[model samples]
Target: MRKKLFRATVLMVVPFFASLLIRLLYVTNKKVFHAPKSVGSEPIIFACWHGELLMLPYLYFQYRKTPNAKVLISSHFDGLLISKTIEYFGLETIAGSTNRNAAKVLIQGIRALKDGYDIGITPDGPKGPRHEVADGIVIMAKKTKAKIALFNVKPTKFWQLNSWDKFIIPKPFGTLHYYSTSEIDVSEMDIEEAKLLIKEGLLKHEA
Candidate 1:
């Protein structure tokens, strides 16, 4: 009974705060937050830390000039929330992660890139050494001939979640900051180079 009550309490609170974040932080003229650039006519893999997931849907709804997009998420229950939120904004999800059929899920993401869809991935995710970059994104971009765009979200009002990923939850009615580094054209760089650059860029953004 206690667990059921706890779960019920969580479900109600999570969505309420999520909606609060949208009301406070999802805004226009994101240009000041990120530099604009053409990501080539080919598809892109938008890589951001797990903490940035809160603003991701809004970023998609606001900045997507493309017709297709899908985010690669894990099979965890949180993935269900992420999936539902993205789909709620007319996006799709390709579920798979380091724990289950990771390769297949990655291939699906690459396929989405090939078929003309932008993809978002959290390099440090599904449980993480928070904010570290993983090589999987580099490998996938290299194989798919896609560019990578790195994003970071700085909250104006939020608490640091105790989850392994240090999931960030923003309180209602506060500004949020965003940083989008330049695209890394994987075709021009090796996997190691891509990973290094992406990692450096994200770290630099945090600093």
Candidate 2:
């Protein structure tokens, strides 16, 4: 009972504060998006490295405010906390991972896309060999014909965590640079080629 209470409290308080911090920092910083104007209107699969998730919510609110923008999060306790946090910023979450229950999540993603939702995924996530692209995003794009917008976020000043992905946190009031590649048509390439293409796009602006 005590453990449950602690978890509940953390879920509520941490997201609240984290959301506030993100918003505060966002307003004080500058960002640029290298995407087409039509990007805001189309349902796209937004791919970024797992470690670069800290500022994504801000990007969503500022630019990609698709009505049905949903993020793919793992079905784990940490994912729960992250979902709660991003929810405060007005994006929905779907809980699943490539490492577990992948088919179920892929089906969910397809359904969301059919309903005109833009999904966010960290292709190398839920446990990473750091920056390695996975096949899940490629498969989803192929199945749904959703354009994949591969992007990277670079903070001028930040701290890196010791975790596997070396998670990044931007300093309060630092500039963030955003870059994206042209929309990828997964149907034009096989999964292996698509993965390599996405990885190359992401690495172009890696910080």
Candidate 3:
């Protein structure tokens, strides 16, 4: 009973603090958008590397006003923290990952696309051999024929975490150079071809 109560308190309190921190960092950062206007349309997949996931809620909100986005997060406890934190930004969460209950993840993603929700996916997330792209995102795009908005960020100042994805937190008052592909259609390509194409697009802005 004590453990359950502690977990509940963390869940309730941490996301509010985390979201506050993100908002603080975001408002202090000078962001440059190098993305096409068509990137955040409905039914699109917003793909980015796991390390660059920090400031993306701000990125999404900058372009999209409907607040109809859902992010693919792992079913782990850490993912739960993220799920709750992003909810503060008016984004929904889908809990599952490529390595665990992958079928459910794919199905739910396709369903969300059909319903016109743009999905935020960190292709190598929930765990990572950092910067590596996984195949699940490619499969989801092909299966649903959803266009992908692949993006990257170059921050002039930031702190990098020691986690597997080398998660970053952009320092206050710094500039963020943001770049994104207009749209990528993987419906006609073979799985491997599509996967490699996306992998390249995502890594383009990485140092």
User: How far is 56's C-alpha from truth in model 2 (Å)?
Assistant: 1.0
* Candidate 2 segments exceeding 4 Å error: none
> How well does candidate 1 match the true structure in TM-score terms?
0.82
Please give the distance, in angstroms, between residue 178's alpha carbon in candidate 1 and its true position after superposition: 1.6
lDDT score, candidate 1: 0.72
Q: Give one digit per residue, the lDDT tens place, for model 2 in 1-207.
A: 999999999998998998888787777777766655555466889889999997886555545554468899988999898899898877898898876899999999988988988999999998988889988899889988899887677888789999998998888667888766667788779999999998988888754
Worst 10 residues of 2 by lDDT: 58-67
In the predicted model 1, the residue pairs found to clash are: none
lDDT of 3 by residue, 151-177 (tens): 887789999988888888889899988
What is the lDDT for 41 in model 3?
A: 55
Q: What is the C-alpha lDDT of each candidate?
A: 0.72, 0.83, 0.85
Give me the candidate number with maximum lDDT. Answer: 3
Candidate 3 Cα lDDT to native = 0.85
- Tens digits of lDDT, candidate 1, 1-207: 998798667765675565554645555213235545554556788888887687766555445754478888887667766666566466788887744687798788878888888988898876777877777788788888787887777767778877887777765556666677666777778767877788888787564
Overlapping backbone residue pairs in candidate 3 total 0
Ranking by lDDT: 3, 2, 1
lDDT of 2: 0.83
RMSD of each: 3.5, 1.6, 1.3
Per-residue error for 19 in candidate 1, Å, reads 5.0
